[model samples]
Target: MEYMVNLEQFYGPMDLLLYLIEKNEMNIYDISIALITDQYMDYIRATEHIDLDQLGEFLVMASYLLNLKSKMLLPDPVEPSEADQESPDPREELVNKLVDYKRFKLAAELLGERLSDDYPRIFYRHGSTVLPEPESELSATPRSLHRVYVRLLQDMLAQDKYQIPQGDINVGEKMSEIEHKLKLAGRPVHFLELCHRDLGRREILALFLALLELIRLGKVTALQEKRFGEIRMVIKC
Candidate 1:
């Protein structure tokens, strides 16, 4: 069997960084900036006829890594100021960003796998229970309902009992639910966790559009601490 590769499967610069770190089993915080930078540049160079527009963000990240490499080579300044003493390590922020991105990326991949596995399993399983319709005022209503239900059941069994498709989602109502979640959170929450993986595609799309609308209206703010990072949504105070 021949295997095909799709470069677009990779999300962003951080994805490449995580690959490098894991490929060599290097600690995230203790990355050898020079080594990783060279490997990253080499990968970019190896891609044939790469679109610079898509590659721009990665190139920018490469420059950042190179700058950090240069900083690592320089001697610590003598007689550092009090503010400098209180400042974080130069690589601390970058490490934190990478760690966060890796976490969400892994989570997304797991969700994808679960979805794939779930789809196949759904076809084989048979539902044993039927929901009982409520009692009605007219005796004829029960008979009519039973006939309709039997007809539907026969059609489903004849058609191999596929899952019923979901109904149209109300975007406006979903937006309100998201707003309520934000209000309850009272802080930024990871966007992925808001909609949930089990939600249908239509529902997810509605939630996403709702988020964008909220952002446009300035009722909420969407932020990424770093490029190619997980988006976080905050309720505007």
Candidate 2:
């Protein structure tokens, strides 16, 4: 069985740090080291399901922040050391950069919100192509697992700097790929079971996207046979 996962769900540490600084309206050059560190920790704690490899630069920054906080806590030397005069605050440069980035982020988000008034979603047809709708139209389209996956893809793409051509991983192709490999191994597993295999989160997400495409095209049926654990997927008749 080929296990897959997607790692695109999370943002890097710099992006996260800028968000904290902007929300607090703090000066970039003169950050309240204590406050920013606390906020960063909150975000780290909030991201509960992080795959260690996908953690991004945030983990590095987190270590830096903690180190800075620790140094600040130590008692001053009994006598001033010569190094004290030559040394500078290690955090000064990072604070300035984060502050500048925060300004740009705020402007972009404001511009985006002002121009868009709709939400986005995907809809799968029983025997045809899945239609997509912006957030403005979700109330009219029924929600299904297929639709949920599409929206997740849409949201991820939207975070990109430029509008790249939309490319879809076909569900039918993925179904064929899975089945052939399964036949080689002689076993069948639940849809979620496939999601749990040992692969990167990003790869797993890509597989789900491909699976939805196949479902939309009437190539497969993803069904749950038991309350939990087992799932059965088969080529559609």
- What is candidate 2's lDDT per residue for 1-237, written digit by digit as tens? 133322234357777676677679977777777899997777776665677876756678888888888776776454576655755676777877766766777898977875564734344667343356657743434557679889999988787847554555555566677666545645444566577565555656777776677667876666765677455766654
Clashing pairs in 1: none
Highest lDDT against the true fold, candidate: 1
lDDT (10s digit) by residue, model 1, range 1-237: 133333345678898888888998999989888889888877776666656787888788888988888887887664666555655567887899998998898899887886674555443345533457877665668889999999999998888757676787987887788899989988888888876778877788898899889898898889998998888998887
TM-scores for candidates 1 onward, in order: 0.45, 0.36
State candidate 2's TM-score: 0.36
TM match of model 1 to true structure: 0.45
